[model samples]
Target chain A: MRAPDLIRFARDAAAGNPLRTVLLVLAMSIGVASVVVLTALGDGARRYVVNEFSSLGTNLVIVLPGKSQTGGFNPGNAITNTPRDLTIDDAQALLRASAVRRVAPLAVGTSEISVGGKLREVMVAGTTAQYIDVRRLPLAQGRFLAEGDWRRGASEAVIGAKIRDELFGANPALGQLVRIGDRRFRIIGIMASTGQGLGMNTDELVLVPVSLAQAMFNSNTLFRVLVEANSRESIELAKSQATAILKARHEGEEDVTVITQDAVLATFDRLLGTLTLAVAGIAAISLAVAGILVMNVMLVSVTQRTSEIGLLKALGATGGTIRTAFLTEAAMLSLAGAVLGFLLGHAGAAIIRQLYPVYPAYPPDWAAIAGLGTALVTGILFGVLPARRAARLDPVESLAKR
Target chain B: MMNEPLIALSGVERVFQLGDSEVHALHQLDLRIDSGEYVAVMGPSGSGKSTLLNLLGLLDRPNAGTYRLEGRDVTTLSPEEQARVRSERIGFVFQSFHLVPRLTAAENIALPMVLAGTAPSERRKRVDQALKDYGLTNRAGHRPNELSGGQRQRVAIARATIMQPAVILADEPTGNLDRATGEEVMRLLEELNGKGVTLIVVTHDAALGARAQRQLRMEDGELRQDSRQCAPRT
Candidate 1:
């Protein structure tokens, strides 16, 4: 038969039994939609985490104090706590690197602050004037600590937004002399209400000069060093240069671990990419199931239409033509199901985006195409047995069945 | 070519395997049918009349011997070639009026041409002429279930003859109809035979068989009688 007539004949046969057609289509569509929606969710999670990490700062290289053992059973270096301490001078020495743009030596401690007849314990972060620039922080009111000698601090402090509200309420908090850990320091600035990053809430911490913070805590060891590279391409250079400079300053001891932001981002991307593929594999199982369903329904259809088949053979339809007709019917049903499933999956992804606007839940192009291709292949593969069975039926016997 | 028969079966033997036992359906049967001749095959149940009809329609293959149609040795032809011969030279009318229930009268009549890959314009023209000739023009759009038994049989006949085959095979064509409708169907078959199409009717009804110019009676997988009259009684 001609292609158009064959298609019409197959279409008519499928339409002849509406219930079976709908069931087969529904099975296939569900399989495809699951693959699409699951992949979208898996990939969406990867994007969300990568976005949060990228928002911290660009071209950042962090220096954690201690020499991490590459491979050994040494318990002392397991937690990366080496005996040698990273001091303020070691952080200052990193400034000599050509790729380093700004360096912030950090020191952290808990202190009780009494101001406006109110006393509260606050987490204190001590750093230089360049700390704001390196961390990309914004000031809500007044100025940050002034730029001066790194060795001597001018007894100035910066209060976080939460601390300012709790201690002063409606009162002006800028320039207030707040006694923190038995030392009186003038509040130089109030920080903007930025949320959390890597577990620390910027809104609730008190910022002070690193020199005074170390003296007040009776410790000479700096907490960490945050380095900002000149550009994205300079991050690796800045990291290696800072490590080498810090090693020389630490009396030739490699005592600090330098890590770039891109390495961490790449690790997360790979982990989530694998997760998306795993879920897609799980969803593909349903397509196989749908293929089997097509096979079962088609078998039943062949048995039920024995008389019709017999009539066609009696009317001079070759077995090959009969086989082609049945296969065409199967393909038509599968194609319809696949298209419906594609639309359903997109709608499902759209609903996910609507509910969680921050998440990008679009299915990848390869995944959508793969789902459609697999559905078609599975349907046709399972259809072969039934088509052959119909072709081999004895016309004389089948005609006598009625 | 003029002396040759339209269908010739010589030393044809058909065997059926029933479990481990073998049953002979047609025992070395020999028959010849000429073009435009009306013949009736009459026999009791299991006497091989149905087997003869099936063999004649090429629906079943003989285990031994040669069968020829239109001067071609058809028994040895490939299945595809046999289908082509069946499509072009043979037509079948079943006892139960086996019209596809899903299709309209018009589509059913166009089925043979459709299977042969006839062009749409030609199929439409021929189907229209068939519908008019069968007096089913008004019922062209109706399915088999919507038509009466006589109308359904008319649709089947129209489908059978749509290809204008050289021979028409009718197997108890009037078995499912009332007496009056049966006579009407017989008259239609006779009308086609009058127009020079070879007609073969397989029936057990003596009265129906008596209307044909030639009759072959079978018993025990063998022909018991072969008789021909000068003319079929009106």
Candidate 2:
């Protein structure tokens, strides 16, 4: 039999029963939409995190004060605390390395800075002259901390736009004093907004020369080291080189760790990818149920149209033709649902972007394709039994069923 | 009968199993229908008239018999083979005038040819001829529900005979129609029989049975009467 005729019959049958068709489509659309939306969010997050990490530069390696995994590392015949040594001294020593471009020892703590009568608690970061270069922070108004300022232990501070607004009005205070806890520091320049980086709003921070932060916060511990590679091509080499140098300086105590932007992003992507698949997998159960629903509906249709099927058979319709018609009906319904789901999911993604644009930035294409493909396959796979049942029906028995 | 038997059923027995209960619908029935013959099988309800028609039409199989159509035994053909045999050699008309509600009369008429993989041009040609032959040309574009009962039955007949099947099995062809409409349908079948197409009508109405050249009366799953009619005699 001609394929078009079977398709026409399937289309007509689906159209004839609007309520059932609509229900099946609705069920399938939810599955496809869920898969697409979750996948988009996860993939976008992976992309964003990778981009943020890349902004930190290639030659950079961060040293933490803890083990990468277990009990602890002993500085001896084995590796040393070099990777885990997150300290200002290591930051200083790294600066002396020939391969390293620049190193900035970073200390962060929260403090309430009061201006006149108003007060706001903001993140206070301490670093030296190359803080801007290593952290890749651009200046908005004033100059970043200089080597001279840090060497002289000057009480100079640079603030983000949000910090400037909270601590002081729009009036320029390029040379006014601001209190860090009880100590006073002269306001220098303001940093440009970098939106949100790794969930921290960069614009909500206050920056001071590392010396002033050390005196004000009353702590000498540096949480992380910021390093910069000279060129893009030597990023990994710079990272490894820095690790070796830091390890030797720290006496082989393996406490510090180095992570490239790509490595961090890969981890983030793997985690998010798993989460997306999990959500899509959970929604797949519902999709499978919807497929079963389609199968049941087709079964009912076959029973209801017993005599009609017999009539078609008597009119010379082959069994294959009958089976193809039902299968086509199911497949078309599934594909239609997938299409509707895709449109709805895109709309959903847009809404998320409008509401939380900073979070999910990119929607991956594979999710949409996978969702549609799964729905179509599910529809046909489940529809097979009913189609075969309809096809194998005896014309005599069917017509006589009445 | 000197004429060739286009349909022959020998020692046919059809039994149905209903929840551990066995019921015989056709019992050792032997029958022969000659080419171009117009015959009506009549019986009360449960008399196996429809069962015999089903067996002869290849819509079913007999457990204890041989059914030969055009000199070929078709009792043991596969389901697909049966469908092909039914499509090419057997036509069907029902009391409900079973025209697909969604299809136009022309599409219905061309269904058999389409299923048989006929070329589009040939299918169109044959469908057009059938529409003209059944006086349904004007109703070709109408769906089953859109046409009157008489017109719908005509379309059904057109569809059934489109492939020029050797045998036409009609079960209560006009049972749902009024007297005038029923007569019109009978006349159409008679006209086709005149064109050398063997026609078999299954009905309970003795008046309708009178129109055939031969009559077979079934009772309690058995062939109770075999009579030859000279002129529309019941």
Candidate 3:
């Protein structure tokens, strides 16, 4: 028969049993939709984490005060040897590198603060003027500490939004004098309300000059040095140059670990990519189950239509023709189910995005295509047994029944 | 071409396995049918009438025989070749009026042509003409369930003749209808025979057999008698 006629005939046969057709399509569609939704969730989680990391800063390189080495760095030596301290001088010397744009020497310590009559413990972060630019911290009011020599002490402090709201309430906080660790300092600025990052919440922080924070804490060592490269391409260069500069400052000992932001981002990206594939594979199992459903339904259909098969055979239809017709019916039903599932999956993803606006819940194109291809292949593969059974039916026997 | 019979079966034997025992359905049966002959095969149940009809329709093969159709030794043809011959030269009508329940009467009538790969435009035209000729034009869109017994039988007949086959093998074609409807269906088959299409009807009804030009009586898996009327009853 011609292709169009064959297709129409199969379509008519499928439509004849409305309940069976709907059930089969529903099964197949559910399989496909689950794959789409789960893959979207997996990819969405990856995107969310990547976006959070991107929010930290662009082209950033972080330097931590440790010789935490992998692969033959000698764990015994790391535990026994006291690593050289990362100080403001090492942070200053990094400015000489061509790829380095800005550097901030961070010093963190806990101190009790007394403002008016209120007293509370607050996290104190001490850094230079470039700290605002490197960490991308926003100021709600007033200016940051004056730019000057890194060793000179400044009595100005910047309080976070939570600190302002807690200690000053309706009263203005900027320019007010606050006593922190037995030293009175004027509030220079109030930081904007930024949510949590890594573990620290910027909304409750108090920023001060590096020298004053060192003096108050009685420490010369820095917590972490945040370095910003000039551009994306210069991130690796900035990392290597900062490490080299820090090693020279520490008497040629490579004790600091300089990590580029892209390295961390790439690691997360690969981990999440594998996770998305794993979930998609799990979802594909449902498709195989749906294919088995198709096989079972088709087997029942063959038995139900035995007389019709006999009639066709009596009307001069070859066994091959009958097989083609049945196979065509199976394929048409599968294609319809696949299309429905594709739509349902996208709709499910859309609903996810609607509920969680920050998540980019879109199924990857490859996953969608693979899901469709697998559904089709599985449907046709399972269809073979029933089609062959229909083709091999004994016409005389079939026609003899009823 | 003028001397050769349309169908010639000789020494044909058909066996059925009933448990561990073998029952011969047909034993060395020999028969010949000519073009345009209206032959009735009448026998009681288990007398091999349906088995003979099935063999004539190529739905089953003889255990040991050479069956020739239009001078071709069709018994030796491959299954595919036999199917092609069946499609082009043979048509069948069943007692149950086996019209597909899902299709409209028109689609059912066009089924043979569809299976034979007939062009859509030609299939449509021919199906339309058959529907009109069978007095089913108004019921073209009706499904088998919506059709009366006589109407469904007419649709089956239309489907049988759509391919314009040379031979029509009918197995108790009027058995499912009332007396009045049965007579009408017999007349339709007679009319087709008058138009030079060979008609072979298998039945147990004696009255129906009397209307045919030739009647073959079978007993104990063998032909007991073959008789031709001088003037067949119209």
Put down candidate 1 lDDT per residue, B1-234, tens digits, no spaces.
999999999999999999999998899999999988999999999999999888888888999989989888898877777788888888999999998888899999998998999999999999999989989999999999999999999998999899999999999999999999999999999999999999999999999999999999999889889999888434
**Model 3, residue A138: displacement in angstroms?**
6.6
Best by DockQ: 3
Quick one: RMSD of model 1? 4.7
- Residue B100 lDDT in model 1? 84
* DockQ of prediction 1: 0.65
Q: Deviation in angstroms for B149 in model 2?
A: 0.8
lDDT of 3 at A334: 85
Which ranges in model 3 have alpha carbons more than 4 Å from their true place? A70-81, A111-122, A128-196, A206-218, A230-234, A342-362, B230-234
* Model 3 residue B13 lDDT score: 98
Candidate RMSDs in order: 4.7, 4.7, 3.7
The residue ranges of model 2 lying beyond 4 angstroms of the native Cα positions read A37-59, A64-102, A107-130, A138-157, A172-189, A208-223, A230-236, A250-268, A361-367, B1-4, B17-24, B119-122, B217-234
Candidate 1 global lDDT: 0.90
lDDT of 3 by residue, B1-234 (tens): 999999999999999999999988998999999988999999999999999988988889999998999999998888778888888899899999999998999999999999889998999999989998999999999999999999999999998899999999998999899999988998898899989999999999998998888999998789999999978445
C-alpha lDDT (0 to 100) for residue A157 of candidate 1: 92
Which stretches of model 1 miss by more than 4 angstroms? A70-197, A201-238, A346-365, B230-234
